[model samples]
Target: MSFHTPSDMKLICGNRNYSSWSLRAWLTLRKAGIDPELIVLPMDTPEFEERIAGYSPTRRVPVLWMGEEYVWDSLAIAETVSERYADSRLWPADSRLRALGRAMAAEMHSGFAALREELPMNCRARQRRLTCSDNAQSDVQRVSELWQTARQQSGSSTWLLGDFSIADAMFAPVAVRFNAYALDLPVPAQAYVAHWLADADLQEWMSLANKEAWIIEHEEVGE
Candidate 1:
């Protein structure tokens, strides 16, 4: 239950209003009780281009700095945090459940291209309307099915699993997308999205997102 907080920990991220990957990593660290120094670089700007190279080899956001070592990619950061803070229980103890969680997280990470393109994670935007393509609709349906299966297996009505794990962190941005676009979903998935929107940490993130002035014009979809 106790772990040493790293003094040299820092998390380099992008504008919270539009960076779903950043949200994932930030939520994971916050859930693990680690508040790293957050460095927000506005995306699609000369500043980001110049500064990102110093922080991430991938030239991406949500890179975690543990002393001189840096971990890029949100999933990698989640895995590292889960391993380093085993006592935090970032993943379920049961092997089967853990496997299922990993699969779900991986699917979210690799798939859902249509959903990501059509329904970008705009935390500050809400009650917006968008006519999703067939592929995007299929993606939403797939996400609903995944959530239903995970909750049914774990008997958890709140989180995807019985507890808040890396799986939840991975899908947290999807929840924001669903809410922001007012995407029509099944009752259970709707409830899940509501739960995520109600999370205090996520609310704090959204609060900061709303205060951000820089907006990615391309990501400003859904009228």
Candidate 2:
């Protein structure tokens, strides 16, 4: 088997309905004015298992291929895009705010395992019911706290850090999870969720997700 590198940037992702990490990287790229060649491989499929190895050493979705170079992780992809497209202002101009945003994004990347597992991202689903574990609830609260902190620190009511930075991209999937499950949240957090839901790019992603036919049962939680 042979792999051919594209002359332009390409992103290999999993299903839009279930792949939160894919959403993060894809949204980051879009925010940076990059419309890469998209390759969607439905999760838990033979095609994904067979083809992923060629694109990613970790065998994961959301691998970004920039010619021969590949970024296999979502946060790394965001960082790379920010560096390469500095004019895009993926990070804020203020050094303090940028540091805060990086910390928040990193937390979202490395933490929140329980919230992630219990409230799997199902973009096409809404008002679903699920009894979350204590850890999951705690994770949700922490996310809310992070958002509130970002808003308070940046003095921005719209997006975290006063603009749509990589931090917002990182937390975009969490907004989906909150909306899908109708999770009870504080007023500020709920407002942030509403803001994210109204985003055109997120709406487009969900529209595509709703049209997809592949269904991974294990991720089909909540009724």
Candidate 3:
């Protein structure tokens, strides 16, 4: 079925320079063909936390408001929209493929702490790839392995499961992190990153993020 015109949805997000989780949720909604209003909060501002209390139960960004439903957390938002709009094909159709997709997205939601903390998404800056702490390196290796395994198993598909799914949306911010930090990936993973970087929507996001006047000092990754 055609999704409720995404144009009607509203997505609340934090600063584009800092909120990777928010990016994940926003991209999922957009790819689902939902034209949600992008609500951005200045992470450094005192009102940031205060403002979120009304819309976000967790007091974080990337909150999804669909009609009366309030979805918090990036992964939850994606799943909610996908299930609500079956035609979006947010997950694969085959049972096993769908299961793998969920597994990947779950892994992303709960794991990869080192990479997330060390290389947080900073859309306004590009830094040379340099020393990664053991923890961060381990996370990077694991992500590359995930992508490799998924590509090999999926065969003809360009994404984790032959087509764009929640798995890709979950990893999308990570992909941006890799690019922003100039982290080189394994050859196959490098190719995947290339695909992600070339996407027009991502490019547009980067452009807007760079143009935004707000700056959150806490999220700045490098000098």
Highest TM-score scorer:
1
- The digit string of per-residue lDDT tens for model 2 on 104-218 reads 9999999999998989999988989889999999999999999999999999999999978999999999999999996889999999999999998899899999999999998
Off by over 4 Å in 3: 1-8
| Clash tally for model 1 | 0
* lDDT (0 to 1) per candidate: 0.91, 0.91, 0.81
Question: Which residue pairs does candidate 2 place in steric collision?
Answer: none
Model 1 stretches with alpha carbons more than 4 Å out: 1-5
Ranking by lDDT: 1, 2, 3
Output the worst ten-in-a-row residue range by lDDT, candidate 2: 1-10
lDDT of 3 by residue, 2-116 (tens): 3345555788998776788888887777777666788888786788878888887788888888778788888888988788764749888878878887888899999998898
Tens-digit lDDT string for candidate 1 (92-130): 988888999999999999999999999999999887998
Alpha-carbon lDDT of model 3 = 0.81
lDDT of 3 at 186: 85
- Local error of candidate 3 at residue 33 (angstroms): 1.0
